[model samples]
Target: MNRRLYRGLREAILEGAIAADTRLPASRDLAAELGIARNTVVHVYSQLLAEGYTRSRQGNGTFVNASLPDSFLSSGRRARLAAAPQPRPALSPRGAAIVDGASASPYQWGAFMPGVPDLTEFPHRKFGRIVSALWRNPPPDLLTYAHGGGLPALREALAQHLALTRSIDCDPEQIIITEGSHQAIDLASRILGDPGEVAWVEDPGYWGARTVLQANGLRIRHLPVDEEGMQVPQEAGGEPPRFIFVTPSHQYPLGPVMSLARRRQLLAVARRHGSWIIEDDYDSEFRFSGRPIASLLGLEPDAPVIYMGTFSKTLYPGLRVGYLVLPRPLVAAFQAAHAELYREGHQMTHAALAAFIADGHYAAHIRRMRMLYGRRRAMLVNLIERRLGADWLHRDASLAGLHLVLTLPPDMDDLRVVEEARARGVLTRPLSRYYADPALRRPGLLLGFACVPEQDIARKFEVLLDSLAEVARKPARAARA
Candidate 1:
């Protein structure tokens, strides 16, 4: 009986039926359940432990050893392991496409990694104090699921902040808190668009939005973006898009603030086509230029625009807090959809964020970071100019945002340069990867300076310059050959 029980348990463990570290049934419990003597179960457990199959913790039950030695298993169990490796489950068509076309970098936070904020500088102590205080005397609703768009206090606080800073015209009722801009985009795409519907995305735009919109079954049209912002197509293609996605305030990677005239043109286009515009106002808070650029939603009252903003860039990315300022007409629909789709929670954090904004910590932090990032940006730009020269690296005229685009020769392969830079501990994103069409792709590098320290910028950038020099030498050597 002991031998039979030991073989069964070992086979179960070896076959992966019982996963590693899974606690086994107590000897007494198993003895009673299986109608076996307690002495038999004890002997089996002792034998298993002696053979390195299980571990007995002091005062705790026996658990399967996480690391199983190949030779420790009996011959009978070894026979089962000799079979061919099982094939992985096949993904759906959409899932397969998403995995194949994924562009997310393995490293998110590093020197010169774009779109990441300086998390080290975050006021964790102050935020912790707020969290601790909330936990001490937490509200009933705070511990429960969020009702109605989100916490009223947070929406009101955000509404006031947006109005003062971005000139957005919105009431607290119009605001809907989201997990992040990604979720906000997903909700907007599904609620506003149907499968096979058209959606216009800015060429060399945010890849994340494109991925989310495409995943929701929207056909994406890449609209060209220049100094003025996303250009409105001269002639209507097959059908007007259900929505158009734009990064109007501090355009992603490129950093072009949408011109007032361009904003009006986009609004006009949206009205003509009866299309909803998703204005992704990412990283607009850290502008180092003139007065803050007004949002497209605020430009024209009742414009068909769904404004999305995230605290990822402003605060820490892990906060998972973002919002959507919807038009009054669409508020009810969005709120209903948000509840149905996301089933939002995180009330405690929402309340804490509201207090943070109300107490003026949010604005104060932004102000301090803006000054620090400005110095870091200037330092990187100076280093690039001094080391690589203006002829080799042409820095784009951008005064806002965390990252800057450095244009290279048209023939240069930015992707190759990016890979070479990565080997030297400098992270960079190639500009060509952002474009939907290969023909329109430009060779450029998106160098992020916000997260990197002002002092470290020169050293890390010098490493990048070395990679650039090597890339430049390759073309010359090939030409001689």
Candidate 2:
């Protein structure tokens, strides 16, 4: 009863129904009028007075406040403020560019949404047990800001694991734990290269890398990716790029493994120009075909490469754990820079992850997902090949990773196709969005297979096909009309 009375008065005051300085009826009078108990009315009146909606006089009845508090501003007040001229919020040139060219989708998970792994198949029980045990009696160090790069246990586990799996033999001290691959890229971009220095980025590369580099004021020079991966020219005709960014294991969007010859040539060219290569080993775990290859960083004893890898695909992304394997010469500096720039933490999560890896749960989970993803990938490829023909598929579509690029004819717009598919309750990304240069943008769709179930993949792909058919008919129907 008091709650109802309180709410009614509050609404009346906010809506301007009860004008300023209007006297509120006395508790006894209002209670009698409303056929309610006097105590309830008194309680409601007292609340309003305490809340600044009303003011009490020593001998007189309560009156509405002349000015409402800022915190008390209601929909009526908000509407008035909206009618006034508001200044645009200021942002720097780099900030403006980042916001304007943002490529992130609001929809993160669903059928054909690229770069996502199946969360349904994750080994949550094993991970949860480890995390729950840690929280029962957490150490003081786990709660504080992480110093000296990251958790020692996690780094040690990662060092051993990377050595055995990827042939990246390094001391635990050389590994710097990061929030994700995005942060790792940001740290490398800011620490390794300076503003205005040229950065050779792959055309149709990861947009996150481009955003971070651009934010750091590095001038990007797009290098075309081929079947053999990023082509390294015989000579640098003009100013040489200070940093060379490549996805060596499996090229993004296009999905080409860098040929060994091209890899050696790139290393030699980079050394000649005094350039550093930033190798992003993204989605390298779930290679669908053949034996998994060794990392580019492990090829030489002291390669001038900053290697980055993430557990986002292998583990769930919400874990927010990634690592940078630095060369011995860079170990100390990068460790210091990471601590200063990011102020890393999450030692508890790091501890849990370390235990998870050490106990072989991580390995077992990856193996299981790899087989599951391979099956889903096969089904998706079959559907696309049967409906659209094998010619429409990207050459390296089946080699590695979660997504495959379905190439479109030159006249068709990939963005329009994406929109049409999105309208049909399906999410897919346009491959053209990955390229920095508008002219170099190719028409293709990056459809993810790992996230979608085998049964659901066909259903979603059917809806996706209707989108393509509708988009294809658009030009022909317009011509006749």
Candidate 3:
């Protein structure tokens, strides 16, 4: 009788039909209900308590343990062990790299994130019309593999757009439509550097590029970024890296436009070193300040530069459209690489996006979003000033991109602040997470304001303020003691 009662309760608890913290029925009442002896129920409860399945609260009744070990609580795991062969960790050189980092909780607060477009303002109707138009009258050539260079019309349109807007003089033949800027980077890495070779990456730069380069097994030399963009080293180091990836247009998370002189110097350095200058013109399209800065590619048209840009930031991520304006010399090589990598052309999407650009709609959309985003950026600055008063961080914040960085107090760890902020229902990231080394860590939060609704900015800021106060108060009170 005792064994039967034990099995029933164990099964219920293990299957989670009876949840943790659920109180068991009274021993005498439960025995009668189950048609068992009262002594049987008592004995079962005692065994459960001893085995940590249940706990007694002295005078109160027995309850399921708030915490249970896996062996006793998970029936599926036990069943799996009984039936199939148990899996073992992989034995490899980079086995540890296969493990994933901790995932962020969704309910966390204060996520001043970056690289997100305002979905609320996405031109769905305009995009929908273009996509539908393409499907209605499909191009037969598009049904087969697209030309390695990409959709001819799209390449020509992109060339014209770059020439007029960015002063980048390029023949459509030299332009290769890529999946995204990341693919372009990967291609450049393969063409220029052998595995285990070196590449210069900006310090406290975009970790996305860092991860990609490292995954390819290339050694990375971290260079510091100043206000004038990636400061060209006074002397090009020996056996200089074959590739140097730079985001000269509003440096990621740092928002510093590269100076014209520095641009020339960078080109000179790359040319002299025989190194490839990988230019990521990611978000230069939406400039609120003065005249748009001509790309480094424009500075030396004949020089070796692998120009890459993405519509992900400008348009939307799901569109998956980006292009590379390669040097005339490397275009054929890249085409061969493209042929090996991509079999089916992304022709339908290419046609739709190309048609959208040709109709003067794409230009208009960029202009409209530029103005709207500028207003939102201004509103954010105003909100911060009005609410925070003099107690704000990063006063000289740049007015570009969908997000900005707010430098934290020198002693206060931004990582700890991010964790505490998450506890209070706000999602945010620390600048340190982006850095390659702890020594290069900047104590600050990377706040992305683009995706977040403008109306909710005040409420979110208030929550952020409250969290900051909590973090600050603890140290202050402790210091006084």
Candidate 4:
């Protein structure tokens, strides 16, 4: 066997030049092309087969093996790719395209990330107690197929909770428990709007909602959010959007509650335009700063708001318990959608959660976490002030959510800064990564402080500062270049 030919062909397949399962040219044909003897080609093929790099069929010729040697896969390919240049993701003809971009490094120093609740103090004992109780007396309905609308007990409890907490007027029958608020959005996209119809989303929004809307083939209009929450533009180009998704309780990523005036204005816009609103009250329970703003859905009881809430943020992400309180008209459609999918809530898990909430334990746990997180949040902000100084950066920070936004210096490359910090074992999200238009890429960091303790914040921020400093020192064109 000609070692050179064998190795070269092996490298080509392993390097993805000749993709997996692609049929290789017959030995005679390949030899003729390479200007080599048929015997040399045959010998090369034989060796490749022996080494499991190619599979040869009796009559049909050879195919590139899906699996290949690591040495073959790594040989000069990555280096060549590193040198090759590529364009940004092409915009999809449909609408605001999700450009294939790199996410912030998973490691962060004092990560000011949003939506992540603290896992350390999750009242595991109480949850276990509820689980034990549920196991002892499981609901008979648990064994039956779900009729699209979820567990009756959970629905009733959620309706009661909403009425009591958010002042939302809704019956258990009008509610449907979804996998999470994410699925609720998906369901809303399906039932509320037709394909290619416009649906409004928050500008610096929840990416999950954006993703679901895009996946469902809805054209998304990015409405700007401010201190008063989503400023619903009266004239949305020409035709009105079918639906608008808003997080009025605490606008995700920004953490601003929708003021009463704006909530009324939004509802008015929805009513005037005959459009529906998906109210994602993702973490209303964890409001650390102000009095809980009443839900927009509650404000306009019979209005066109599809109120969505999730226990994922309040209790835990793993629980996957969330409910949508729909307008009376859309209830049938959502129920039909649920039935079509044969979607049933996890009976055992929901039963446990129901018990947990039913007992005063859930309230007690929230009370504990609120205090713990309040201290952590205060400590995080103080450390940021003491370490970074207030005047050095704009402190237009939000007081409610798990994380806060910090504006970076104009010259900084947020993506690169986050990457460098992550290399030093700190993770965070660059605000730019969330934007569709490159011009909207604000140079800033979103620090998630819920999961990490107070003692670790200073050390993490110190490492982050070092990474930022290193990035700052590098020539603008050189670091990323």
Candidate 5:
């Protein structure tokens, strides 16, 4: 009898017939109605409360548990009801747009996939040892919420390293450690620009940066990029933008080091317009050519440039550690904003990274990977020229960075070719998809050679080349028909 009563009540709750928080009848009234003793009703109600199906208030009557799990209430009948499909709630306009424009690949690591480091080569044993030691004897401060702009030890180490290598003139105080360059960009966009304000981004630029700016409600103005990097607008036709995004060190996808004259000209434009420059120095450490180009921040010490760098390319992406070097005046505001917004904390990892840099392991690892990647880059270029033929596709003369852009015929659909190539197990990003304005986009493929093994490069290129060759033949075949 109790089993029958319990099952019925549970089914009602799970099926939404008896909505959450609905009070059950008094024990006397229920007992009389069901033709059962009052004690029987009390026992059943007590059992329901114990099993978390319902709750009881001392003064008031018993009620159904608002937070009861579906599994707890589900019976033979309720199980069938649970399987019924329900309509999903509508997403906001911005949310829907973000979902529609999603470009992240399902698979991260493979041949020709860009911006991924060789994780197998990472010194995990050394890092693990450091982590183990720190965990065994953890400091009070290390376990607490991080404040006042990242770990001091890591900041100091980074300051020394950046000064020595990138020629960035900044103290530890001016550096704000973040989860990655993505967060650094988000923080900068929020603090620097307001909703509906103008922001300038390179036409065929990093899509990630463009997405961040757009998500912050900033109106993105697509500026064309040439061999000298982003072309600074000479004449002020309209109102100045709040900020300008650039990858000057090694221009993303289509790698072009911004010339000294162009850098000065860009600075002049920014100064005249009173717009801040967001310089993303991602993957600058992997330069295989002449002397490394100094950062724009270093060129003009007092320039309004927020320089960002991430260890994702150099170390591993999972580290989720990156830094932003801001001017002295903007440091406090950024620090406060970072704290209020992100509240980032990875003290142990930061300490380990600091020790790794200070002990020379970080620099040593970079030197090893640089040599490995250089060979890989040359092999890929050689294969493209030899197997694919230079007449059909022109490889961008990029002396640095992990990826190279191969320009296709103006009439070709790079996106369609990329989709077909993915079917053949060769991953490549279509260059046209990176542009904010589709009308201004050029047909090209961004091939990443850094993560691919030396031996696998030949085989992978064969697959990619075949797909591209087939694609090239399509238009000709159509014309002949």
Candidate 6:
């Protein structure tokens, strides 16, 4: 990277390709365009400065020197390195797998685009006021690396909140704050699992969880879900999995609450196998109807479960706050491991969040959003049921979460529909990509209603319907023969 940048820049100056005193792009801007680090560009600029190829003003930016000698064109070693043929960059197999397995969407904000909450509804003014107050006279500890897993106040506040809302009873000491649920998953995978150990993830499950586990070298085992939720084996056949990642409250993509019997079964099997049940209770809040289900961790005392929760869905993704509630025995291990790996310290944000929760702002906000999302979800369902038909909606898919699965005909191509829909301005995710087993992939779309406005919902639905119109009219069992 340096050789290319350095050579091209100096050659341009020496050949008078770039006129004298021409200001170059800012380091950050150049770095962004080149997809490289800003520091890398700065390093290149420094070299040019040292070689009298460029000059810099205090605040103006780097500029081509007004006068540079002609002798610099024959600058010995650099000429050879720059002229040498450069091979394509290579990545480790694990690194390439992580990229191939990635399912995150860059276009997260739009109608029917899944997994993003409506950030516009967040109490930015109130939350900002609290955050601003902290920075007025920020404490020194807030800026330093924190050895503590998290600020005690925030952990305690979360502990109380979970106990009341989700029926998860855990001490504040069991909580480990992380940047987000992904980081929490990574930490859990690293601490609880060894390479090549199995991690049983739900089929058509949350891809992010699987990607993180796979990156950590755990072989993935896809377990199918049904009306009763994940179907774990009766016993650990041979070797038990080191990790079992699940969303028992409301299964992702496909919706079904893990039945009481299944929950009991999972607990017993995990215990027998000495497996760690990683419960990702993400978006447990905003249940559209009835009381939310109790967490898997609470079903049995001393259940080897690590409860992972996040503020991304409840609050906003940019908040960068998620936590893990470990079993009593795992507190020390996770706390130490998290601090060592992530260096979890966000004193000001933690303090502000604790205050927000303690003072009831957090609860109050959820109450409002719960009602808001309920209306939107109902509206989307009504529109679909009226125009398309009830058959299209997954009747068993949980009524909770920011998105719901819209089932398509077996002959329909969900990936093609998604692409066409996106081109027509209706963003959605193809259900086919969520499955680890290619054979198990279903034809469906995950339509997110949480982020879309109520007035715009119908308009967006019409656009999406147009995209599906092509396959909607075709025969389901047409044969090429």
- TM-score of every prediction relative to native: 0.83, 0.88, 0.77, 0.76, 0.83, 0.84
**Model 5 Cα lDDT, one tens digit per residue, 1-481:** 9888888888898788988899999999999999998898888898888988898899899999877766655565577687878788799877777778887778778889888888888888888888898889999889878887799999999999999999987899999999998899999999988999888888788888888888899888888888888988885568788899999999886788899999999899889998999999999999887888999999985998999999999999889999899999998999899889887688989998989899898999999999999999889878767875665344345678888778888988888788778999999888888887777788888888888999899999888878887888788448457
Query: In candidate 1, which residue pairs get closer than 3 Å at backbone N, Cα or C atoms, i.e. clash?
Result: none
**Which ranking of candidates, highest TM-score first?**
2, 6, 1, 5, 3, 4
RMSD of 5: 7.5
Of 4 and 6, the candidate ahead on lDDT is 6
Residue-by-residue lDDT tens digits, candidate 4, 90-158: 667543444443233343223545566776678898789778877797778885567757877778777
RMSD to the true structure for each prediction, in A, is 7.5, 3.6, 12.2, 10.9, 7.5, 9.0
> Residue by residue across 292-332, what tens digits does model 2's lDDT show?
87888998777888899999999878878999999888888
lDDT of 6 by residue, 202-278 (tens): 99899999889999999988988888888899976667888899999989878789999999999988988889999
lDDT of 1 by residue, 1-481 (tens): 8889989999998888998899999889999999999999999999889988889998899998877765545555777788778898999989998998899888888888888999999988888888899999888877876667889999999999999999997899999999998899999998889999999999988999989999999999998878878888855688888999999987776777788888988888889888999999988898787888889988877889999999998888889999999999988999999988888799999989999899899999999999999999888777767866765443335688888788888878888789889988889899899988887888899888889987788788788888887888788448448
Error of 4 at 207 (Å): 1.2
Clashing pairs in 5: none
Give the clashing pairs for model 2: none
Report how far residue 260 has shifted in candidate 2, in Å. 1.1
Question: Each prediction's Cα lDDT score?
Answer: 0.87, 0.89, 0.78, 0.78, 0.87, 0.89
Of the candidates numbered 5 and 6, which has the greater lDDT value? Answer: 6
- As a TM-score, model 3 comes out at 0.77
Best by TM-score: 2
Where model 6 places Cα greater than 4 Å from the true spot, the runs are 1-85, 471-481
